[model samples]
Target: MTEQISVLEKKIEEVTKRISDLKDIDSIRNLHHTYGYYFDACLFNEVVDLYAEDSEVRFMGGIFKGKESVRRFFCDRLRMRHSNGHNGPIYGFLLDHIMMQDVITISEDGKTARGRYRTFMQAGRHELAEGLTRQWWEGGVYENTYVNEDGLWKFKILDYRGLWHADFNTGWAHTPPNLYPFFSDTYPNDPIGPDEILDIVPKPVLWPDTGVLPFHYPHPVTGDEWDQNKDLNTSK
Candidate 1:
């Protein structure tokens, strides 16, 4: 009877864990989608609220650490375009941030999670003086970490690995990103550190022609989980 009771308890624990994971997965999905809509509408404050206090955001090669910096990235650099009135839409926000192919995995402890998704964005820009109106398409991937705190999910790290940006008229085939990289009329705070892989401009190599942002997690098929104790050569 004792042995059978122990087995029953184990089964119950497993079931409970599955239930928690399912709930967490749904919550996380909703959370990220909420972030997208908020950002698209230029509701920068709401967007910032989606992150934890110590959250970090890495977008377009700039790594912004902490909530205040993240706020600046959205509210200052992006939303207001550093108050220079050159880039982005002049009247209203013209961000069409579409996310797709999302894969989320909650950890066994149920306290943290990881997600991977791809984004294809449509952006609008207007130069007030030049009367220059333009539209562009951009593509990138996001590998993010999240944590469950106070019964809510918040972004711990949002790393957006930008792939390319192309003019709507010329399209991606005609234009490579580095050749015509974005020239900001206004500058924002410096990044914590930019990823060095794409540092070289006018290079012999380019994205897709090069490779993708490496998975921060591990091989799903091989189950070679990431290990802090191991180096790149040692797949734990």
Candidate 2:
């Protein structure tokens, strides 16, 4: 009788473990999809909804807090520039892929969870700078923490550190037909010089208030000299 009782106890423990494992898997799977969908749709609001109100996001060397701040960080700060005729349209498409490595843990209280994953992203013919067109690929890992709030799971923290990135410059070297030039040639009605152009169209703001992250590595085209030239030309 004692042997039978021990066997039953062992079976119950095994079953509980399996169920817990399954739940953890499901939670991680949902998170993978959350990132993909948010980026694909450019759903800033929805993206924030996936996180806890006071969640923190640390990535690309910057740290941001709260859902509203996170939404603004991505939507307002990140800039993409494309040229017309000089290169091509300034805006292009993006593709993002995410792979889950593991759900490190689902806290015993079930109020917190943690996971690790890898991501590969491709940007097609996007605008990198004035008169420049490019494609880029980046791969990275994500370390995330989720919290349960009001019986719902939400992300409490997300950290993304890229491993490497490949830049394909001048990807759209060919000019498109019937496209307008980046600078207008039409005279008084048009921008006769850099001053007029700059007045009408301000330069893009590359970095945000969060000084945590280095906006980008100094590339030749976007170097100090280029910035000085832009300022000088516009001032004229």
Candidate 3:
């Protein structure tokens, strides 16, 4: 009878752990979704808040490291480009980040996780705006890492690979190659540049070019890792 009780207790502990992992997965998913919404609205301050103090962001082959550097990238550079230096939403501007198809993996310790998601973005500025009023379609993949900080989840690394871009009316088939260029210069030198320009192998490209943003998780069934030796373009 005592042996049976011990077996049952062990099973109960295993069941509790499984439940905790499932909850962690869902929380990580929600965290990324919230980031998408904040990004779409150009909520730079809020977006920065979602990241951990020691976090880093990888975008367009540039690495924005640390909280201050991340703030400069989003609050200064991106805000200036999208919202005319405003920290919040603006008039006659639309940037909707539709985040979906998320795959989240939690660590055994339950303190860290990795997630991959597809982001379909629609960005445009109405004619009322000062600069060129144009609309575009952007597809990207985010292979982000997260951490549980005192029971709150925050982004440890926000890595985004923008694969393709096309004019809203023209569509992707007629899209031009290298529509968006990667940063060639570092911060302070470029003023609104990345802290460090990464030496990404094979380089990243936009539209018209084929690329594969490597998966963060191993194959679920096969448990095989992606081979990175092949010349795989990091761009769309």
Q: Which 10-residue window in model 2 sums to the lowest lDDT? A: 204-213
Model 3: per-residue Cα lDDT at residue 221: 98
Q: What is the C-alpha lDDT of each candidate?
A: 0.71, 0.53, 0.89
Question: How does candidate 1 score on lDDT?
Answer: 0.71
Clash count of each predicted structure: 0, 1, 1
Q: TM-score: which candidate is best?
A: 3
Number of the top lDDT candidate: 3
lDDT of candidate 1 over 1-236, digit per residue (tens): 99999999999999999999999999998999999887777677788889999888766545567888777677766655422433323463367879989888899889999998899999875554333467788888888999999999999999876677778898888775355333222233234233222332332223434335655667878978654333323111
Per-model C-alpha RMSD: 6.4, 15.4, 2.0
Candidate 3 — which residues are off by over 4 angstroms? 231-236
Poorly placed runs, candidate 2 (over 4 Å): 1-14, 78-91, 126-132, 169-236
- If ranked by lDDT, best first, what sequence of candidates would result? 3, 1, 2
Worst 10 residues of 1 by lDDT: 183-192
Clashing pairs in 3: 163-236
Sliding window of 10 residues with minimal summed lDDT for model 3: 227-236
